[model samples]
Target: MTLATLALTWRHLPAAPPCPRPRVRTSEAVLLSVATLALLLGISQTTTWGWVDPRTLGLFAVGGLAMAGWVWLTLRHDEPLIDLRSAFRGAAAAPNITALLAGAGMYMGLTLLMVLVQVDTPSGWGLGQPVAVAGLMLVPYSAMSVLGSRISLWVGARISPGRVLPIGCALYLASTVQLALGHDHVWQALLSMALAGLGSGSTFATLPVLLVRAVPAGETSSALAFNQVLRYIGFSVGSAVGVTVLGLVSGPVPDEHGFVAAMAVNAGVWVLAIGVVVRAIAAR
Candidate 1:
């Protein structure tokens, strides 16, 4: 699937506009890389290392300080890796937040679903699906996401992009709710996955449009790049949160209650994303 998508994107790619490459800021890049690595490591090890462990705390502190320094350096430099100011304002901020939230919600959901399906049924929670069946169940989600993207494009032609964000968020919110309450049956699970795909596809389709509308033509690439960064950050944070939530309820393996609780929490993330996008629009 990945290879096919890559081939398709490569085939339809547009000719590049003539633009000089931006000069590298080695110091800023190095500092930011350190922060990202440390933060990711700290988060990943929270379960294994124990959250209160000095090593974990130290890594987080170092990462935070390095991130702060990197931000300061970028604002001070004339030719920084990215123009942070423009990217963090107006229409860009909402979609970026949405990207982050979407990242978090999507990853959390994927992890939850994978666990919910495969754990032993005797645990009173999982469906006890074989690994292949579990993978097959996700096919609807992948297919629906593509359809949802096209649907977003169609909807975008008729409505404001701001409207699209909420619509997308709402779909995922509904999906999460469905899974939280009605996931006893495979059909229900499939429906939740479909809603998730639609919701995600809507946001994914609209984000680039919002980003382009927010920035000048020259800064578009940088703005999108920054947005991508936020999405990855969201993914890391979501993975951490999912692990933490499940850990709190785990015994031998996570209980069914943990899966339900995690889905509920992720649903809240969707709500927060909706609020952020709405507030950003209001701020404009």
Candidate 2:
């Protein structure tokens, strides 16, 4: 199926016209890479190194300084790696911000759900399911996300493309709330995944469109790439935070309360994304 899809895409998709290659901003790229790596390391290792440990704090400080340097160099350079100024203006800014929040929320929910499923039933709220069963649970989410993508396109054509993001965020929010309130039953988890998939598809699909429309043709690739970077950072942060919260609440084995707390945080993130999306639309 994957091969066939790839073949079809290769055969049908139009080749992009060649454009002049921009000069590589080596320093900016290095700084950004250093910052991303340091921050992610610090976040992911919090459980092991402890938050206030010098190693963790050192990583955070390095990441922050690198990020600051990247911004400063970017602002001064005529042809920087990414056009931060243009990317943060108007509609473009909305999708980037939404991507960060939504990405974090989505990842947090997914990580928590996986852990919740595999947890031993003796924990009172756990399902004690095997890894295979837990993996199968994501099938609905994967299938529904494709359907949601198509649905968003249909809805966008009929109404406004801008509205699709908020709608998607609402669905994601609903799924998080559902998970927070109940997950004792397998059916409930499946339902939540389905809803989350739809929301993810809708928002993910719409973000690119909004971004493309907002940026100049020449900067499309860079803008999209930057948005993806933000999304990934959000994902890393979300997963780390979710695990941290669960660990903090309950030692090695997380309980119902821990799961609930993580989901609640995820839900709040989605709410914030929705508000940002709505505000962006209103501003326009």
Candidate 3:
């Protein structure tokens, strides 16, 4: 079904029942953060290398099993920090889809753009830099993300999260436009990245607010964790699109021109995201 129809349907779902919010222990929160960060780093880096020997694979398997055991032991107890029930049935499914699409749009957008920057030749507009050097070019974008995150945190404190999500959708649209109109050179790309950063910070940080409002207090963590999982799914799909599927299309084959094409697809996704958010707001 179309996103508009889904949003309309979601708006009509019965309000969720209230449940007690378990207080978070500080130690659990700290350990959770550290473990999550470490896990993310490990997962995000695996694609960089080609393969692993049997010994390395054996180590990975053992480590993963150990981590799983730790998590299970932690959550299986009474007053467990992780609530699994809420995750399965929070807000209507529309917002979940929105989260996934937005996440995919952000990751694919960056990866394809980076491809564009390094595809330079006289025939195309790329800067023709090596991947190592191109990595340096993204520093500004990362810096801007930090600034945007801080700003989003402030803005979220004052505004409804529902509003922030639409703003993110709009900013992503703006980034899409800037990249589509490539005549402006490097500044335009940088602007797109900054705009992207703002959108990313706004939408991601506040998504749980919507999730929380829709679910029982007891389900808060569970609902939010599901949302988090979807975001990672988006990230994975985006990587495949940017790194694999886009290349199969006829063009410069991962060069600037190909990147332009890939970004155009991402732009379309952004437009759909905008529609999803708008329909949601209107349905309310």
Please tell me which predicted candidate would have the highest TM-score against the true structure: 2
What global local distance difference test value does model 2 have?
0.90
**Candidate 3 TM-score over all chains jointly:** 0.64
- Regions of candidate 2 where Cα sits further than 4 Å from its true position: 1-19, 121-123
Candidate 1 residue lDDT tens string, 1-284: 99999999899988688889788889998988898888888977887887889999999999999999999999998878878877666667788878989889887887788777777756577777899978976788888889888999888889888888888889989998988998777788888889988888887888888898888887888788878878887887787787678768765577768777888889999999999988887777
Cand. 1 TM to true fold: 0.89
Candidate 3 regions exceeding 4 Å error are 1-92, 255-257
Q: Which residue pairs collide in model 1, if any? A: none
Taking all chains together, the TM-score of candidate 2 against the true structure is 0.92
lDDT score for residue 120 of model 1 = 72
Query: In model 1, what is the error at residue 143, expressed in angstroms?
Result: 0.8
Cα lDDT for residue 228, candidate 2: 94
For 95-181, candidate 3 gives per-residue lDDT tens digits of 677888988888888877776667765666676667876677576667766776676667777886666777777777688778867
* Per-residue error (Å), model 1, residue 69: 1.7
RMSDs, each prediction? Answer: 2.6, 2.2, 11.0
lDDT of 2 by residue, 74-117 (tens): 99987788999988887799999999998899899999999988
Q: Please list the C-alpha lDDT of all candidates, in the order they appear.
A: 0.84, 0.90, 0.67
Clashes of 3: 0
